[model samples]
Target: MSSPIALHTIQYNTQDIDNDTLILLYKNLLKPRLIEEKMLVLLRQGKISKWFSGIGQEAISVGVTMAMNMDEYILPMHRNLGVFTTREIPLSRLFAQWQGKASGFTKGRDRSFHFGTQEFKIIGMISHLGPQLGVADGIALASNLKNKNQVTAVFSGEGGTSEGDFHEALNVASVWQLPVLFCIENNGYGLSTPTNEQYRCEHIADKGIGYGMESHIIDGNNILEVFTRVTAIADSMRQSPRPILLEFKTFRMRGHEEASGTKYIPQELMDTWASKDPVINFQTFLKDQGVLNESLEIAIKEDIISEINTHLKIAFDEDDIVPDKTNELNDVYKSFEYQEIEKKPETNQLRLIDAISDGLKQSMERHHDLVIMGQDIAEYGGAFKITEGFVKQFGKERVRNTPICESAIVEVAMGLSIAGMKSVVEMQFADFVSSGFNPIVNYLAKSHYRWGQQADVVIRMPCGAGVGAGPFHSQTNEAWFTKTPGLKVVYPAFPYDAKGLLATAINDPNPVLFFEHKGLYRSIRQEVPIDYYTLPFGKASVLRKGDDVTIISYGAAVHWALETLDNNLDIQADVIDLRTLQPLDTETIYTSVKKTGRAIILQEDSLFGGIGSDISALIMEHCFEYLDAPVKRVASLETPIPFLKQLEEQYLPKNTFESELKSLLEY
Candidate 1:
């Protein structure tokens, strides 16, 4: 016969918690269980769409939530419904949220625990369980900076431990010594994959040893043990801020979701875990201790059922407000009216890099809540020395040097934004952005639309070719972000525009991708204002004016068009530089195209799926009647950026743009 499973219980005295608090914890535990049971019935009746049942793991959620203070933040997953209830979130609103009603937390945009409310200090988990760990680090970072002495608790499953984000978050948290309680609910499986197949480590707590973080194993099924252990750990962390990993050994009694059954789980394992159901075991323990009797248990059960019914009626009584196209379209981005700063006549001849650094310095002076985070940005001054004396001027608290962790740092920036602070994340190279793409597209881009939460963050991408840095280092990847709905993509050609546009991006109440062409950072020089100023987005700058033909471009491609026009004096054309790609200046393009009667869009990205493709389509759709000839697009070859100068020169459109422009002019 197999040995029986070991169970952990309260090792310390329980006298610290009074009788009333103990009973309150019990009530909190019972709330999610009863509510989940009722939700299952609703699901069966087709009243609800789907459900992720936390039927067996109520103790860990309730105990951890009860242990944390009201001011402290808790980021919980779908299996942690008890966290919401224990925090006193309105059950009616939660029901409305599940029903996709406008009165719910996400206002019908997202379902279940995918939304967060700042008022309750509870951050909802995204479908990706691991990113929340990084987000917790961000919140705790804010706490550390503000001297709040607050501890943040973030939860995940054993399955999430396999993700790179899990390791990055833990490493960064430990490196910064942030006060975070990483609670891992070891429910023995991730979806259908068993623990044996998931990891070779003996226990999840062993992962913490590599990170040099303190860890503990807990009986997740025991409410009293979870409560007492977490309480002690949180208290210690607040006094001496650091991260601790707590592995709550438990099991998932239901499938990953309602549709996926538990058939994959062995019958013996299921039978073993069924005997240790958190709700039933805790209730039995409470009864055995004389804290509850038959009459009290019956009364509590009746009251919970009545409460669930009352909330259900309120939720059902509110008419299901389906999301409309108009509202859905309008809510994609939050508008922050650009406040123009007083213009100063003082000017300095500076390079594009200098102008960017000056603009960042001025903005940091104006906004106290603004922070800069990137690898080697502080002491080492970043890859291109953009942040070179910022550490001394702004202090290490505001200008943080993160580890070589692009994914976690980006999510950390979002966390800072969630705390009502502005953050600037400098990508060492534009190609490195692929590591942090998930948070930018999924979390930051969808934040406002999903929950009316603006991500006041900026990601500075140093991009472009011509330095012979090869494919990885030199890539015009601006097209990747232009297609994303919530992101504002900005690319400047000159020093003056670089400074003004960067200032605007930092203050905008939305996520912005600021691309700086490294080729022009030092090569381009102009007189830029030393004082703070803002430039309006979705506005095109006409560098030169002519009536023969219109040449439209941005970034380094703009300069190439201007040079081509200057050289070929016979070919008079209006050169338009699109400063921002997301909020595109279509009006300027249309007006210029109508006047010139011809247009050629130029870009450094490959020919296929470039931003130029969309511009070409728009011109055809809107300016078809005004065009004298077919709209042309001049772009790089449909291949990776070449390494050799001769091949690269041939690959990019700069050398070929003049020919394309002449062809369009002739037609």
Candidate 2:
């Protein structure tokens, strides 16, 4: 029900500048305008590319930064050349960033304005639109866990409010009541489509009404008004344990990026919006206050020009790229193999989900910096009830309940993980994870390679068939993540194994997706170890070792294999659990296949381009010498999972999906 966010109006004089002397209120507004104007000019001249300039949105950025303490976190997008500059990114270095120069960040290796200074508490900028809101919440949520007073401020454009991530981030923030400010730069157009045309809503600010958030829409050009309201909200948000939504009505003086020319924009409207430009309007306000004299104005202009030139010089001087730096691209997009319980001693006392849940709970206990947030995961204890009583144990501060925005949850978790905390984000259902694919594939998967960074995030998706939950509820899309590189996918069929793997994933330096089959939670129960035990990734397990043929699968398929074996009419199959699908246990799979001289892959997911396909490819590449009958597979039909029970049963892989095994046994 939430719509695009906007700002509310407020008025104040310089006295409301947080009772501080060094940082002036008008100066905060002045700084944003000065820097943003330079950035716009750069964009206009082709000196800058991908500029989301804050031309008319200066007040919001200035106000937010002013409201924030120096130690509080601020996550800004490309538009906030103003935001970053106000927080201490040297103007020259900031300008050098537009030139893609080394003197900026990583000697210019990072995307423009995408790098954050740890000292300034600017976690970083995310250009992938609404995703940063989650990241900001992550920082705020972490601060809460650490029992710190720091609040994180996240800024985005009105265009981004339409994105799922924006809503996702906002919902989570509201539920957790984290000390964060969600500001929307509501500049009428999301690349020429009016906000009204693309969306239906009274106001983006009003959108926060449903989720326990305090919402406001400000005249974005009003600097004094912005600073006063933001200062009060940022100061009070921590006490209420809630987030605030401020929509700043502004307009872009230039195109979306550097090249779009605003061809779709009507000139009259453009001129009218421009007439309320933040920089010009604020300057007039300063003049009225006797603060804008010729000497002071000249000084500010000269300072900006000098800073830009300095940055340009640094950029040109060190703009050289390493010959092989770009070559590292391939590894950045690769995924790892899913492994089972490693060399750790095997015990007969554990089930998979129990193991995973224990691991999640234990890891969170060990690392106070780790946060586990999901829908109804706190008091309701998760749909599978994995986190039962965690709200009482961990408190609602650490165990969060979020609105259903799976994609934004993943993004926020990733951003928080990247900013120095471990995050476990849960999807109530595995089938719902598709909502998060945009940031997961385009950003999280490549961030380490792109930024030489690592974000530790665990996504627990309750997946699979057989729960009678129908099409939308039952899905095993681990392979979708399997296909994407830089993601570690784990599908643990047993409880104990699940706990250990979940723990390892929590501690690992990269992103890990842990899928729990909702159908398996109660079906396979065992008493897991009371103490901590870890399972290494990329290690497969031989469930029932056999020599006739190898049956490889994970999650419910492993259970199906056991049932199929119990009803045996086929060859003795060596069933292996691909515990972690990515970073696959090739040696175990290949060795088993080689010894058996036959292999039958089984999975509940569709047949085409799945983890099974990857397993086949690996077997073909390594164990071809051991093949007896063109590596057979038993899987579901390549079609949508049906709503009708009969059709769903017909479409899914069942225990009877043993044609390959039966034929081999007959032979």
lDDT of 1 by residue, 532-581 (tens): 89898999999889999889999999999988988999987889999999
Q: Lowest-scoring 10 consecutive residues by lDDT in candidate 2?
A: 1-10
Clashes of 1: 0
Model 1 lDDT, residue 379, Cα: 89
- Model 1 — which ten-residue stretch has the worst lDDT? 1-10
**Tens digit of per-residue lDDT, candidate 2, span 10-94:** 3336663342332255556566565565566666677666665556666677777877888887888777766786776776566
- Scored by lDDT, model 1 comes in at 0.90
Per lDDT, the best of the predicted structures is 1
Query: Model 2 reaches what TM-score against the true structure?
Result: 0.84
Task: Give the best candidate by TM-score.
Answer: 1
The models' CA-based lDDT, in order, is 0.90, 0.74
lDDT for model 2 comes to: 0.74
In order of appearance, the predictions have TM-scores of: 0.97, 0.84
